[model samples]
Target chain A: MQRKKSRYIVSYSILLILICVFVLLSICIGSVTISWKEILNCVWGIEKERTYADIIFQIRLPRAVAACLLGGALALAGYLLQTFFHNPIAGPFVLGISSGAKLLVALTMVAFLERGVKLGSIGLIVAAFIGSMLCMGFVLLLSKVVTGMSMLIVSGVMISYICSAVTEFVVTFADDSNIVNLHHWSQGSFSGTTWSNVVCIGVVVGITFFYVFTLAKPLGAFQMGEVYAKNAGVNIKRFRVLLVLLSSLLSACVTAFAGPISFVGIAVPHLIKQLFQTAKPIVMIPACFLGGGVFCLFCDLLARTLFAPTELSVSTITAVFGAPIVIIIMIQGRKK
Target chain B: MEKKEYYFHAKGLKVGYKKKPLIENIEIPLKKGEILTLLGPNGAGKTTIIKSIIQQLEPLGGVMYLDGEDMFAMNRKTLAKRMSAVLTNPIDTEFMTVEDVVGTGRYPYTGKFGILEKEDKRVLKESMELVHIVDIAQKQFSEISDGQRQRVLLARALCQEPDLLILDEPTSYLDIRYKMEFLSVLQELSRQKQVTVILSLHELELAARVSDHIICVNQEGVKGFGTPEEIFSEGFISTLYGIKVGNYDEKSGDLELEAKKGKPEIFILAGNGTGSALFRKMQRKRIPFAVGVLWENDLDYPVAKALASEIITVPAFCRISEKKIEQAKQCMKRCGRVVTTLDLSILQDYGSTLRELYDFALQNQLVEEK
Candidate 1:
């Protein structure tokens, strides 16, 4: 027990240190880079009007915080879905939830742009939420008809493919000054996030996190299986609804802000589980949140800085690192 | 006939899936501390009944009263606080220790976050020790053997501190020793804690030995329900299992498949139940044989009844009669060999009869097996 406690402490400290390093990297290494000293001075009001303050406070700070919140949301969403389906590969992106959210957000953007109206942050998140729930409903229905977990994943991927196809179709035809930014946002980057977007994402993701954390107990019982979970006094009907609502909400919030980032949902929870060496939800929820936040901060930094003055898409960067972890899980699942 | 009030009873229960009944009219009255077991063939709805009782599958139509309260009407939280089950489907969990798995049984008592209090942890430890799984308390659940897993699952069930424990074929995949140990754990728990148990078992011998009350179910319906003595005496188990290939001995709780059927060519003088192994050997070799002058109450009577092609029997304690001796002679006329399971005490008790049998084998040129 003492050894186990020490392991958790060590894992938490490592994650905290990594998150701090990545947060600093995200703030210090963007275009027109600012050093930590200058960034600290900018925050302390030494040069309030300088380009460094403008860049750090107005631009990079919100984007970095958005990455932390949305990235953690994506990983929390992944862990719940994996627990629900009892499949290691189950995730918000692979299960088409983010694609569903992105499709509706894209449609909402195009509809408002054609009317010469811009979609506010709340409207996009609400639209994405409906789309996410719609896809989740169909996935639930398909899960019942499909006989195996593999088939369910295949169906999720097919759903993902269809949604992405529709989203890309919208991206092709909608060409305006607003659609140019829409096009950039549709490819999934943490750029251009404002302070208001950060507050909105933080509130929504924070409440969902509180609810998911409260559920760590029953979620632990639920990992045993449905029958045992019910036998353990979990109100199955209510618990299931909560799982669907919370996972969909978290993933939808991510898609609303940063478009559909892939593989982080499926990859980061698995990496944290392996690192912690236990699936106990109490430890895993916070660990996954930190691990995912650091991962996305690191990837978001690279996405903006790898070929500076020519930013890469965040999905492209995350796919490069996260897709291989998913493949490893699949191979190990088969070998076992 | 029904003088005492049963602590639990089901009246005209209809158990099935999706409103379709497979086995209906299941009437059972169980005392508070009794261990009742359901014995049946595959797909005979034992699991269905268990699932229904545990509220996994809603019963199609039934009024199950537990301690005089409608079972289905009780709030699930209250029911969950009182009842727990171990199903046949294996729990495929990852990274959960045996203690963690067992700790889940404290669900009804824990706060919303399920932080285990000191009492809950003590109960978890106590239940694991009851099942003698404290040694493997730190082992991963998935890494253990099936027997250990079953024990751990049972300990999880026990951690509920339930008044009633329900198990669906809990010993389906365990070895004999583990099977006995599993049932004995149930026995100990029910006896000490008054945790009424209703579990289905596949091992008929274990079922006969362990169950305080027996329930026989088949495709038709509930065939019988009573104490083990009342149920095992009526040849109902064989009928319940529909055994045409094998025989179930109600007397000894033993089972056997039918022997090779052909004309008898060897006769054996057997007594005091010494020819059972040889009888099985001949049956395996497909050789037809007959035995004579054995009492009906010998130790090998059930095996002999199931395997021997021909048997000539006398009363349980009487000497061999002239008519039976003549019948044995007639039956052994086609035999070319004689085997005796005789000893010196029997030779002294029936010296003249033994001498006559030996001389008969000699005169007929039948080779005597030493």
Candidate 2:
């Protein structure tokens, strides 16, 4: 028991160190490098305007915080999906939630470009939210009709395909400028994150995180099997629906603000599982948050630094890292 | 007969999938301090009935009462307090210890958080002791043997201190010894604690021997529900399985087989509690069988008595006597075929009765020695 507690403490400390590093990296390594002292002074309102410190404080600080929050939210969403479906491969992307947001963004851009209306980031975020909500609503409804996890996954995949087709159709008819916007949105990036968007994502994720924490025992019961969970006094139907809603809301918020950043959602939870050797949500939730923030911050760093001045899409960096981890897990799981 | 005060009462209960009823309009009463075994063929809705009673599946029609209170009116927590269940599916938890798994039985009383008090731990320890799994208390649940796992699951249910404990085919995956041991444990638990047990069992003999009440379910729908003797005598077993039970063997206390023509001479070499099954099958086929040099206190002795077969026995020890040898020779003289079981004692004495039987078969050409 002492050994187990020490191991838990070690893991928690490592996550804490990673979180600290990511926060420092987020604040310190932007376009115009500001000294740590200047950044601190600017944050504390001791620095004047019209300086690099002001840009660092006003723009990059909120953007970095948004990255951390969105990363945590997406990772938590993925953790819930993986447990709820009892499928290791399940994620926000697999469930068509990301595709739903992408489809909505494409539609909004196409319609606005046709009417000579220049759509803002807020307009796109709203459209993404509506799209994600619609997809979540459809999946929730299908979950009622389907009892098996595999069947629900198949239904989600089919929905994703349909959404992708619609997005493709919009892309084909959209003007050049609108097509560029849609392309950038589909390949998720954190370039447009602001203070308002960060606060919105933070609030939504905070509420859902608290709700999921309360549901930790039920989720642990689920690992035993659904029948056992029911026997243990869990109202399976009600708890499952609530879980899905919270997960979908978390996924929708992140996708809305960050344009559906990948890998962090799909890979962080799984990495946490390997490190912790458990599927309990109580452990997985905090692990997912820290792991996601670190992963996303690292990927963001790579996306910014790999091409120097030219920015690469965060999705590309995440895909390169996440796909291999997922493959390795699948292969190892199959061998077992 | 006086009606027993039942702890769990199912009244005209109709359970099924979708809209169609699987086991329809069946009324059964499970009294406290009773072991009720549900015997049925596949797709007979025995599991369906158990699931419904446990509220895992909702009954399509009719109501169930638990201790005179409406079953549906009780919340899951209250219902859990009244009843606990052991399912056939293996629990896939990796992190929980045997103690942790069994302690979850206090979930209903502990509320959703599963906080354990001194009384709860005492109950958990006692339940573990009852199942004889206290030695492996700190072991991970996944690392236990199958028999040990089954017992641990029982321990979990027992920790609930529930009035009714439902089990679905608890002995389906167990070996013969574990099967008997598990049933005996259930029987003892019910007798000592006044806990009502309702388990579906496929082992006919074990179920018949241990259960106080038997409910035979089939396509005919709740074919019979009464005392074991009452249900067995009603021909419910034959109807439920669509197989004939010719006669009851008073000695072995098992159903005997009717005689058939063209019987073979079978010399069973089983002893030291073995060959009961071979004896039963040989009786079923009406093959004339004899035992050689069986000890006085062996499982086959009772079987031989039940079948009314000729037997040779030594009072004690491994030494074969002249009188027993003569009895065996006399039986061999009248028999057409000679069969020997692969028993350890018979194998040890390769040059004795086995070789003697081989030589007799060779000379008489009655059968080729196997």
Candidate 3:
């Protein structure tokens, strides 16, 4: 027990340190390199040059915080999903929940933009939430029809394909004036985030994360499986509903803000589990949130600066790092 | 041990899926510290009945009382405090240690964060110790053997510190020794702690040996409910299972395969437990055989009765009469060969009368050398 506690302490400390380093790196290594000393001076309104302060306050800070919050939200959503289905591969992106949200958000954006109206952050989140619930409902129904985990994952991949195809169709044949704006968002990036968007993402993800944290006890019981969870006095029906709702809401929040980042949801929680050597929800839930932030911050940094003149979308970078972890989980699952 | 008031009473319980009752009117009267076993073949609604008692499924048409309180009326947490179950559902977990799994049984006792208190930790230690799983507490739950996993689950259930315990085929995947050890832990728990145990068992011999009360369950409902002696009555298990090809010994709770048929190919002079091995060998070889002039009270009587094609027997404590001896001669003469579990060198030691039959077989060259 003492060793386990020490491991938890060490893992959490490492994640915290990594998050700090990544956040600082994200801020420091942009198109124009700025040292931490200059960044601090800019924050304190002591910088003589206004361009550095303007860039720090206007663009980089909001983007960094958004990546941290949305990434944590995505990972927490994945953890809830894996627990719900009792499958390690279950996640927002893999289950096509993010695609579902992306599809609707695209449709909503096109409809609103065609009318020459602007859609707010709240409107997008509400649309995303509805879309996530719809996809979640389909997945739940599919789970009933096909009891095998691989079958469910296969059907989820199919759903993802169908949703993404429709989304591509909407983006491809849309009005020429809207294409430029729609194309970048469709590819999924942490760029173009504003202070207002950051506040919205923070509030939504914050409240949902607190709720997920309070569910740690029941979620721990649930890890043992449905029957044992019920025997442990957890109201399985209600608990399952709560899990679905919280997970859907969380993934919806991430999709609303960041436009469907891939694989961080599945990869971060798995990495956290390995680091802690335990899947107890009490530790996994908070640790997943922090580990996810660190992962996305690092990935977003790479997406921004890996090629200085041309930037890659966050999903492209995340998939490169995250897909192999998922494959490893599948292989280990087969061995078991 | 003799409490006048019943601890758990399930009166007219109807259990099944989705409001369709598969088995109805299951009345199990159990006292504190007593073990009630549900026995039946597969798909016999034994699991259904147990699930109802644990309130996993609502009773379709009846009320169950635990310690004189209506069970269904109690809320989930309250019910969980009083009762715990180890189900047959395969527990698929990832990255969880045995201690992590066992500590979850304190769900009802823990506070909001579900952190184990000092008392809860002590209970966890004691429960692991009771099941002899302390050595594997730090091992991954998935890495352990199935027997160890079962015991860990049992320890998890024990950590609930329940007054009433329920298990569904708890010994199904266990080996012989693990099954014995698991059942003995249960027996000790019941005897020492006065915990009321209700479990379903597929092994009739284990059930007979461990259960204080046995309820025979089938699709038709409770077939027979009584002490082990009453339920395992003569030929009752055969009737219960619809055994068409074997014999069930009520006294020893042993099952025997169907006997070979037709006329005798071999005859043997055997008695006092020596002939049973030869009788089983003949049964396995599918050869019909006969034995001669043995007393009914011999140690080999049960197996001989189960497998032999024909036997000439004398009543216990009776002197070998000439009629029986003549009957033995008739049996031995029909077979082309004869074998003896007894030594022919001690032919006079067995009885002077039996020397005539062996001498007859020897003169005809019918006896096979051992």
Candidate 4:
């Protein structure tokens, strides 16, 4: 117990340190590089170069914070989906929940932009929530019919393809004026987030994350499987519904802000679980959130800097690292 | 209201899936500290009945009273505090230790955060100790051996500190040693803590040993419900399972497959407790055999009856009469071989009739003296 407690502490500390490093690196290294000294000066209001403060505060800060928050939301959503389905591979992206959100948010964006009505972060999130719920409902129905883990994943992949196809179709038909903005947001990036988007993501993700944290106990019970969870006094029906709602809501918030970032949802929670060497939800939930933040912040930093002036989508970099981890998880699952 | 006669009582219960009754009018009345076991063949609705009681499947029709409170009326959390189950449902958990699994049994008692208080910790420790799994409390639940996992689950159930415990085939996959260990823990808990236990078991012998009351179930419904002594009456188990080829020895709880059918090829002069092992060996070899001049009350009677093609015997505790002696001599003369289970010195106490018969076999070169 003592060793496990220390391991959890060390793991969380490592994730926190990584998050801080990535956040700082994200702020420092950009198209116009800012050194640590300059960043410190800017923060202290010295502003040796005014552009440094402008880039740090106006551009990098909000985008980096958006990456961290939305990344945590994705991973938390994955954790909840995994718990809900008792399938480790179940996640927002793979299950096409994010694509479903993407499809609906795209339609909403085009429809509202056409009418000269701006879609706020809240509007997009609500639209994404409805979209993810519809996808979740379809997956739930498929889960009953398919039953096999691989088959469920196959069905989810199929759903992903269909939703992405419909989303692309909607984007192609949208008015020319909104196409550029819609196209960038649809590619799954943290590049264009504003402070208002950051604030909205924070409030929604914060409240939902706290709600999921409060469910850590029942979630722990649920890890034992449905029968045992029910035996342990959880109302399995209600708990299951809450898991679906919260998981979809988190993924919806992510899709609304950053489009559907790939693999982080399925990969980060698994990595955290391995690091902690236990799945006690109390620890896993918070560790997953922090680990997710670190993962996204790092991936977002790489996406922006790896090609520099030609910034890659966050999903592109996340998929490069996160996909292999998911493959490893699948191979390990098969070995078991 | 009628006075409560049983700590856990269910009357006229019906259980099935989708409100279609598979077994109805089931009655389970158990006292505190008593164990009632459900026994039946596979797919015989034992799990359905147990599931109904656990509220996993809503009882098709019934009223269950636990400590005189209507069980179905109670919420899951309220009932969970008083009743807990160890189900056959496979647990698919990852990275969870045995301690973590067992600690979940404190779900009803824990606070909002589910942190274990001192009392909860004490119960967890005591429960693990009860099942003798304190040593493996840190082991991964998934990586443990099946026996250890069963014990761990039992420990988890015990951690509920429940007044009434329900288990569905809790000993199904466990080996004999673990089965004995698991059931003995349950017995000790029932005896010492006065927890009423209800479970289903496929092992009739284990069920007979552990259950204070046994309910016999078949596809039709509850066939018999009584104490193990009553439920285990002569040939009842065979009839219940529709066994035609084998015999279930109610007296000794021994089960034997269909006996070899043929004329006797070997005859044995056997008595007391000596002949059973040899009898079983011959049965396994599918060889026909006979035994003679043994008192009916010999310790080997059950096995001999289960395996032997023919037996020439005197009444229990009676001397070997001349008529029986002649019959045994004639029986040995017809067989190709004779084997004496008793030593020559020990044979003297079995009576002179058996000595004369052995001498007759010796004269005829039929007895294989060893």
Worst 10 residues of 1 chain B by lDDT: B343-352
Model 4 chain A weakest 10-residue run by lDDT? A46-55
Q: Which sections of candidate 4 miss by over 4 Å?
A: B347-350
Give a tens-digit lDDT track for model 1, residues B69-128. 888888877988888999877677889999999999999889978889999999999999
Q: Which number leads on DockQ?
A: 1
Q: At residue B342, what lDDT does model 1 achieve?
A: 60
Ranking by TM-score: 4, 1, 3, 2
lDDT of 1 by residue, A1-336 (tens): 898889999999999998888888888886687877887788789876588887887898899999999999999999999999888899999999898999999999889988989888899899999999999999999998997778988999999999989988988888656667878887889998999999999999999999999999889999999999999888899989999999999999999999989999889999998888999999999998988898899889999999998999999999999999989998988887
Model 4: per-residue Cα lDDT at residue A134: 99
Give the per-residue lDDT of model 2 (tens digit) for A1-336. 577668767887898898778777767776667678877787787877567665675676776787777788888888888777776767887788888988887787788889999776567657776887798888878888997656777888899899989888889787876777667766788776667777777777788888888887778767767887677677788988887778777777777666767656778988887677655566777878878878887787778768867889888899999989878867865664
DockQ-based CAPRI category assigned to the predicted complex of candidate 1:
high
RMSD in Å for model 4: 1.5
Q: What are the chain A TM-scores for all the models, listed individually? A: 0.98, 0.87, 0.98, 0.98
* Top-scoring candidate (TM-score): 4
Residue A187's lDDT in candidate 1: 83
In candidate 1 the C-alpha lDDT for residue B235 amounts to 75
lDDT (10s digit) by residue, model 3, range A220-274: 9988888788888999989999999999999898888788889998999999999
Interface RMSD values for all candidates: 0.8, 2.2, 0.9, 0.9
Mark the regions of model 2 whose C-alpha exceeds 4 Å error after superposition.
A41-49, A108-130, A137-155, A175-179, B1-4, B111-123, B135-138, B234-236, B244-260, B263-370
DockQ of each: 0.83, 0.35, 0.75, 0.80
What's the residue-level lDDT of A303 in candidate 4? Answer: 87
